[model samples]
Target: MGMPASPAHDTVDPGEGLMKKQIRTTLILTLDDATMSSFVPLLQKGVQVKAQLGRSMKHLLCEQYGVNPEYLTERIQTIFLDGKVVDNVETTTVKGGAIIALSAAMPGLAGATLRTGGLLAAFRDGLTHEEDLEAVDSHELGMVTVKLFNLLVRELGPVLLEKGVWVTREDAESLVKRWADTPLRAIDHVEMDGLKVSLEELAGLDWSGDSEYLLLRAVG
Candidate 1:
């Protein structure tokens, strides 16, 4: 008689591979308490579509939910499985898979913490506006700024200076001058050296101390 099938063997499902292959994304949503209630289901759907997740999110939140994508995206950080490990790379992302963490960072206290953390360099680059800042919480917002600044300084700081992104004290001064006008949104480029500026712009953006940091999405 054939040997008894192992318990692990019988329980193994073919879909397990497919499920593992499935894009795992973690979304860090930054919204008011009222808005989070609406996002839960939408987030469930986002993980379903995988590649179309971002598009789906944009449609539901931006179009249907009547929320600003930038405002929401800024507060969210998706951590997914990737390769290797490095101290500088606090966040990991894998293609087709994303893990999300949500938090609110409006301004005030968070901004102060961010400035103290040295993330203010980017905001010293440009300015955005007031209404934009009101949408997020301080602590949540500050962490993103810190991450972005660290990434830029680590990866692109040399190149930006080499390419004249900024060199002289005049450039820094000019950016500081512009800060009085508004708060700027920082951009994180995954493929292009990971230089992010939005965090800095939003550094002085909000002053509200209500928010949380989504540290880890999911680990497999």
Candidate 2:
């Protein structure tokens, strides 16, 4: 699958891109409730998950990930597949290299208009996501980006972290800064692969090269 690696170079953006064909570098951390709160906001930036390319957003969440349909409908108020706003989840298929962003209702008219099948969908016109008419259906394994915002960060971020998600090099650098403010020693636990690792060691990591992922798992 074609995935564009995030910014390890001058060219890429902080979020919304595919990870390069990767390194299985995983760092699992267990933290106290207070410390874990620090990581929840990262979901708004975006995290990577492996998925079948042709599934619809409804199946991707409800069927593949076992998210409650009612919760998805009631709690998730705005949806973006890649960067476009979505008015329909059932018909719009997520492709390889796609990013899916979820949020509770945003404030003001932007929320009313951007919400899925909301009363103001007509106002969005061509801005809404549409299914590809000639696209081939594929069961291909690929990485997909999922970003959670507002309340969904607390509601859904942990679920993705528990399963493990890929973070960019930029996220790693930000993590170092966060850890500096709040020491890694304060974290409940941490492991790289299966071995315990200190936040200092993680902070000391040579982030200079192209091994652009830090597969982070949260166990609390």
Error (Å) of candidate 1 at residue 201 is 52
Q: Estimate each model's TM-score.
A: 0.18, 0.81
Measured on C-alpha atoms, candidate 2 has an lDDT of 0.73
- Global lDDT scores for all candidate models: 0.24, 0.73
Task: Specify the poorest-scoring 10-residue window by lDDT in model 1.
Answer: 138-147
Poorest lDDT segment (10 consecutive residues) of candidate 2 = 1-10
Candidate 1 accuracy as lDDT:
0.24
lDDT of 2 at 72: 87
Which residue pairs clash in candidate 2? 4-18
